[model samples]
Target chain A: MIFAEQLTKSYRTKTEEVKALLSVDLNIPKGEMFGVIGPDGAGKTSLFRILTTLLLADSGTAVINGLDVVKDYAKIRQQIGYMPGRFSLYQDLTVEENLQFFATIFNTTIEENYSLIKDIYEQIAPFKDRRAGQLSGGMKQKLALSCALIHRPEVLFLDEPTTGVDAVSRKEFWQMLQKLKSDGLTILVSTPYMDEAEQCDRIALIQEGKILMNNTPENVKASFSDPLFAIRSNKMYQLLHDLRDDHLVQAAHIFGEDIHISSEVINQQVIIDALQAKGHTQIQLKQINPSIEDVFIKLLMHTESHEQHS
Target chain B: MNNIANNQREVVISATNLTKQFGDFIATNAISFEVYKGEIFGFLGANGAGKTTAMKMLCGLSTPSRGSATVAGFDVSTESEKIKKNIGYMSQKFSLYEDLTVTENIRFYAGIYGLSIPVIKEKTAALLQQLNMESQKNVLVKALPLGWKQKLAFSIAIIHDPAVVFLDEPTGGVDPITRREFWEMIYSAANRGTTAFVTTHYMDEAEYCNRISIMVDGKIEALGTPSDLKKEFNSATMDDVFLKLARNAKRIGD
Candidate 1:
C-alpha cells in the first residue's frame, strides 16, 4: 500500500536543472504487483530512489504502509526491501558473505528468513563460496534478490531485476516474483522490458518524467483505440516502406518480418486490395490483437497528436 | 565481387569440440560453432548455461580443458596474446573507473590498446559528439547516469577499433528507450564492419541480433536468425521459443 500526492523530483546542476520526475500522483494497492514501465531517463529509477528513501523528492508527499517516506524514513527503510537496477552489493564479498552481511544489517539472520528466499538462495548455494564479482550475471542477480528478501520486508521494490539476466533466468525470476506476490507482499517493480509489463497486476507507463497511463495490463491494452492489422509478403521490406507512404495508414512500422499497421479503416478487404495493386503477392493480412508495447506506442502517438493540436 | 566472397569465407572465430572443466565438473561440453566476419551474433542462455565460459575461451581469457578454438585468426590456446590485442571485451558489469572523467576513461582505454594520443583525442571527440555527450566530457563517470555510463563504456570498448567486440549484457538495467538507442550505437559499429558478439537477458533485445545461439546444459540447442529459431521451435514469439527450449532442457535432465 503506497500513496503519492503530486510527487516531484528535480536535480539542480551548476548550469542547468534536470527534472527527474514531474508532479505525479500514484497509488499502489496493498499486496499487488505494481509495475513502473519506462525507457531510459524516464524517471523510473528516480521514482524508486525516492520511494526507497535514498533520494528526496523536491515536493509532494509519499507514504508507504501508513509511514511517510520523508518523515518516517528510517522505519520505511526497515519495512521494505530494495534491489537497485545496478548490482550494488559488496563485490569483494562472497555470495554467502553478502547475504549474511545484508541480513546482519537488518538485524536478522539468513536462517531466520531462509523460507522466504530459499527458492532463489538454492540456485546460488553452490556458488555461495564464490566472490560476488566472480559470479555470472544471472548468479549475481539471484544473490542480490536473495539478499533483498533476506529480511522479508512487507514491501519489495525491484528495479529492473531481470535486465541483465538470460531469458531462462529472467523467466525464472518472474515466476519467483509471482510466488512472492502470492505470499501477500506488496511488490513494486520497474522495468524497461514491455513483455514484463504484462506479468504485473497493474502498471504505470512513465516517460519524460510523467505518468502517461496507469491501469491493469489488459485494461491498458484494451484502451488502444484504433484498428490494427499485421501484414506480411514476399516483399516485406518494400511493403513496409510502401505501407508507411499510404495516406490511409495512420501508423506503420516493421515488427519482425511483418508490417504492423494501425489505420483509420477496419476493413481488411480494402487493405488487401491496396497491397495487391502495389504488386505484392503471397500477402497475408490479419486483424491482430495489440500488445502492451503497441498500446504504449499508440498512446505516445496520441500524446504527440494532442500536443500538436494544442 | 571477390571481396564479398572472401569476407563471407573468413571465419573470425571457430570452435571445435571445445570443452571447459573445473576439476571433474564440465562447465562447457564438447561444443562447436563459427562466427563470421562482421556479423552481430547473440550468445544466449539461462544462468549456468556456459555462455560465459564459451566466451572466455573465444576471448582467450581462459584455457579450454579439451578441444580447440581459433579467435581472430589465432589459435586460442597458443596465440591468446594476439587474440587479446585484436578483440575488445565489455563485461556485464562494465569496468570503467567511476572516479575518472569521461575523457579520461576513454584515454585510459585507448592507452591500454596502445593508441596514439592524437588518434585517441580525435576518436574521443567524434564518439562524444555521436553520443551527444560532448558537454559531459569533463564530468566524472560516477556523476553520469546509468545510460550514459553504458554508452561511454561501449565507446571505450571500441576506442581502439578492435575487429571484434564482445558485449556481455551491455544494456542491462537500461530503460527501453535507452536500450533502443544503445542498440543503434551497436548497429552503427556493426555497419562499420565491426563484428559484435553480445549476450542479453531481455528476449526482445535478442530479436535485434543478426543471428542467435541458445545454449542449454553446456551445449547449443538452437542456432539461427531469431525468426528462424522462433519458427523452428513452433513458437510465435522469442519468449515462447526460449520457454520451449528451456522446458526441453529440463525434460532431458529429468
Candidate 2:
C-alpha cells in the first residue's frame, strides 16, 4: 500500500525554480496496478523518487506499507523495489553476479526468494555467465527487474520500464508485470505512452506537475463530453487544415490517417457539404468513440483554457 | 497543405537484394524496397529484425555486404558521399548540441551541409519564426521542452532542402499533442516534395505513413499501403498486422 498527502518538491537553480511536484496526492491500494501517466518534466519521476525515499520532498508526507518514507527509509527500502528510468544494474558484471550483489545487499540469498523472480530470472538464466552490458534492451530490463525483486519486495516501483524497448519487448515486459501483479505485488509504474495507461487498473494523468484526472481508463474515456468523429479523405493533410479552419470544429487533431474532431455542431451532412465545397473527394466521416489519448488531449486543452481564463 | 498524390511521384530510393553480414550473422538479408518522392514511408520491425541495419545502409552510415541500392538517385555503395548530401537524418537521440543556443545549432548544421552564411541566416530566421520560438532562439538547447527540441531538430535536419529525410523514432516519449504537431510538420514537408523515410515503434504512427514495410528476421515480411497491408493480413489495425508478422520472428527480444 502507498499513501501520500499534499506532496510537493521544487528544484531551485540560479535563475528560477522548477516545481517538480505540486500537491500531488496518491492512494494506491494493496495489490493494485497503479499508473502515473504524463509527459516529460511532468514530475512523474520526482514523485517516484520521493516515494522511494531516494529524494526528500520539500513538503507533505508519504508512507509505504504504513512506514514513513523519510523516518523509516531503511525499512521502506527493504520492503519496496525501485527501478529508475535509467538502467542502474552493474553492466560489467555477469547477470548472476548482479543478482547475487542485490541479494547480498538485502541480507538475503537468491535461493530464499527464488520463487518470487523465477518466471523472469529463468528467462535469462541460460545467459547467467554473460555480462549484463552485452544483453539486449529487453534482456537488460529483465535482468534489472530480477535484481529489483531479488529480496521479494512487497511493492515495485518501475519508471518508464518500457520506454526505449521495441514493441514486442514492451509487450513482453508488460506481460511480466501482469504476472507479478497477479502474484499479489503492488505495482506503481510511470510512462509517457498513453496506450500503456490502459494496462493499469487505475491511472492518474499528471501534467505540469499536477494531477488532471484519476480513474479507471474506461471511466476517464466515458467522461469525454463532446461529439467525436473520425474524418478521413483522399487528401488527409488538406483535410486536417480544412477542419482546423472550420468554425464548427472545436478540437481537431490527426489520429493516424484520419482527423479526430470534437465539435459542438454534430451534423455529418454539414461537414460533408463543406468538404465537398473545398473540392475534397472520397470523404468519409463517421461518429466514433474517443480513445484514451483523445480524452487526455481534451483534458489537457480544458486545463489550458481554464488556466488562461483564471 | 496538399495531398501530393503518390501515383505520379518519382522514385527517390531504390534497393535490390541489399544485404549486410557480420561473420556468421546476416543482419540484413537481401532486403529490397522503393520509396517515392513526396511520400511518407514507414519502415517497421521488432528488435533485431534488421530494421536498423537496413536503415543504416539506406542512410549511407553503413555499407552493405552484398547487393546494391540507390538513395536520392546516387548509388549507396559507391556514391555514399553524394547520397549523404541529398538526405537528412534525425534519430530518437536528440542530435542537437545541448550546450549551444538554438540558433547556433541551426547554424552549425547548415554550415556542415556547406550552405552559404546568408542562406543559413535566412533559414534559421524562418525556422525560429515557423516554430514561434523566436524568443527562445538565444536559449540553450537544454532549456527547451522535449517537444520543442524534437521539432527544432527535425527542422534543422531538413534545413538544407535535401531530397529526402530519414527519421528513426522521432516521436518516442513525446506527449500526444506534441506528437500530433510533429506529424503535421512531417505532412507539410511531404507536401513540399521532401520524401520521408521513417521508422517508429508506435503503430498509430505507422498508420499515418503512405505505405509501410514490416521487416522480420532480416527480411521484409510485408510491404504495401497501410490499408492494403491490413486487408492482406486480415487485420483491423496496423498493430495487429505487425504482431501477426512479428509473431513468427526467429529472434524475439534477441
Candidate 3:
C-alpha cells in the first residue's frame, strides 16, 4: 500500500551537508507489517517524515495507498496514523480528551470509530480521567495509539514507540502492533531495536541513509554464510580485548553472556588458545545460527568498508 | 584488569532501604544495594519502577524521605555537595553542547569540574587522540553522529576522573557495534578504578554488568549477577528474567 523510489533529502549546514536519505526505495504491500530497523541518524525518521507527508523530500516520488505524497498530501495525512518518536499527546488534556481532540481535528468522532480502537483503548479506560502527562510511559503510549486510531486511518506509522520503555513494556507495545496488523491495517514501524525486527512480516535494515537489506527476518539470518560461534569465559572483557588483538579473530562483539565471533580458527579448542592462551577459565564455545543482530552487524561493517574505499 | 577483579574490592556506593516519597506516592521504596569499586553495576527497571528516583537520591539531586545511602564514600543526605563533587553523572536527555566543538566541549566540562588550565589542555589533547577523533576536534558536536556524540559525552563525563560514573541509557539508540564499543569504554573506565553505575533498557547490556538490580514497584526485587539471576529465575536470558520480575510491577513509569 506504500511505495517510494529514489527518495533523497539533504540538509546544508554552514560548511557541510547532511544527507538524510540517499536514493531510498521501498515497496510495502497492503496488510504487511514492515519494519524499518536502524540506529539513530540512520534516516529512519527522515524517511518516515517524507512518506507521512509531514515534510517534503528534495527528490523522488512516494505514493501512499496509490496517492502521490506531494500532490495528495492532505489526503495521505488523513488516511495515515502517525506516532512520532516523541509522544505528541496533549499533556494538559485527559486521555479521553486527547482522543476526542484528534478525532475532532480529523472531522470524525471517537464513537464513529470506536470499533477500530476498542481493543487497544479499553486497556487505558481506567485512567480515562488522568491527564496524558500524568500517565506512565506504557500508558502514555497506549493513549497515543488510541488517539492515532480514533480517526480510523488506513495505515499506521510508529517510530520507535518503545525506545526508552522497559523490556516488558517494549514487548507489550509490539504485541499491540501485532494485534493491529491482524486487523488488516498496513503498518510501517521504525525502531533502533534489532530484536523487534522479528515481530514484523518483513524488515528493511537501513544505515547511514541507505537500505542495507530488505527481507524476512528468517531469510535475512539464513543469508548469513559464515561459521559463527558464541564464546565466553570468566574474563569476558579481557577475553574480548584479547580476541580483538589476535590475528585469527576477524570480528568479535559482546552479545549478552557470550561473545559472538567470526574468526579464522574454526576449531573450538584452537580458538580457545587464541584467546590470549591463558587466564580465562570456565570457557564456553558453541557454533550457533546467526541472529538478526549478527546479520545486521555484518552488513554494517561491509557498508563501512565500502564507504571508506569509495 | 584481572588483578583488580579480586575479591578485596572497595565499596564505592552503598544503600540501605533508600526510599523517596512524593506526597502519597512512594516513588522509590526501600531499595538497597552495594557497588564495588571498578565494577559495572547495571540499574534496571520497568517504566515507573523507581530507577530514576533511586538514582536521583543516590546522586544527591533529591533528598530521600526515608532510609539512607552513600556514594563515593560520602553520605548522600548530609554530604550532598561533597557527593556531587566526587561523582560524574550523564543522562541521554542532556549532554554536551551541540553547538560547541569536540575539544571545546571537553575543555568546558573540565573547567566546570575545577580542572586547571594546563590540566584541561593536556586532557583535551589526550582525549581527542584516545577517541581517535583528532581530525574532528574542531567540528561542532552537532556535526558528529549520535554514536560519536555519545562517545565524546562519555569521555567528558569522566574527564575529572570521579570516583564513580553514572550513565543513564548512554547507548539507547546507538547501533549494535557502537554500543559494544561504548561498553568497552565502560570496561576500560572500570579497569581504571572508576566504578560505573549504568542504567539501560537493553537486556544484552544488563548481561554485560558484573551485577544488576531489577527494580519493581519502587523496590529492588532482584539483584545479582546475570548468571545468578538467570538461574534464580530459571530463565535462559536476562531479558526473560526482567520480563518475569517487571511483569509483576505495580508502577509503570516514564
lDDT of 2: 0.89
lDDT of each: 0.81, 0.89, 0.87
Off by over 4 Å in 3: A305-310, B1-6, B252-254
Task: Provide a comma-separated list of chain B TM-scores, one per candidate.
Answer: 0.92, 0.97, 0.96
For residues B1-254, what per-residue lDDT tens digits would candidate 2 score against the true structure? 22447477699999999999999999899998888889899999988899888989888989999999999899989888998999999986957999999999999999999999999989999998899888999999988888889999999999999999999989887777778889999999998989999998778778788889999999988998888898999998888899888888888556
In CAPRI terms, where does candidate 1 land?
Answer: acceptable
Best by TM-score: 2
- The TM-score measured for candidate 1 stands at 0.77
DockQ-derived CAPRI band for the predicted complex in model 2:
medium
Q: Give a tens-digit lDDT track for model 3, residues B1-254.
A: 12136668789999999989999999998888899998889999887788888999889999989999999989999999998888888877789999999988998989999999999999998998888898999998988878888888999999999999999988888887788778788888888889999887778678778888988888888898888898999998788999998878766465
Q: What is the TM-score of each candidate against the true structure?
A: 0.77, 0.97, 0.95
Candidate 1's DockQ: 0.23
Error of 2 at B191 (Å): 0.6
Q: Pick by lDDT: which candidate is best?
A: 2
Off by over 4 Å in 1: A13-15, A52-55, A72-154, A226-288, A297-310, B1-10, B95-162, B247-254
Give Cα distance to truth, residue A47, candidate 3, Å.
1.1
Residues B1-254, model 1: lDDT tens digits: 00022333568778999999988767788989887776778887776778779899999899999999997789989999999999888864856999999999999999999989899889999988877887889998988877778888888888888889999877755644455457666766776767888876457667767778888888888898887887898998888888787655541211
What C-alpha lDDT, on a 0 to 100 scale, does residue B61 get in candidate 3? 94
Better of 1 and 2 by TM-score: 2
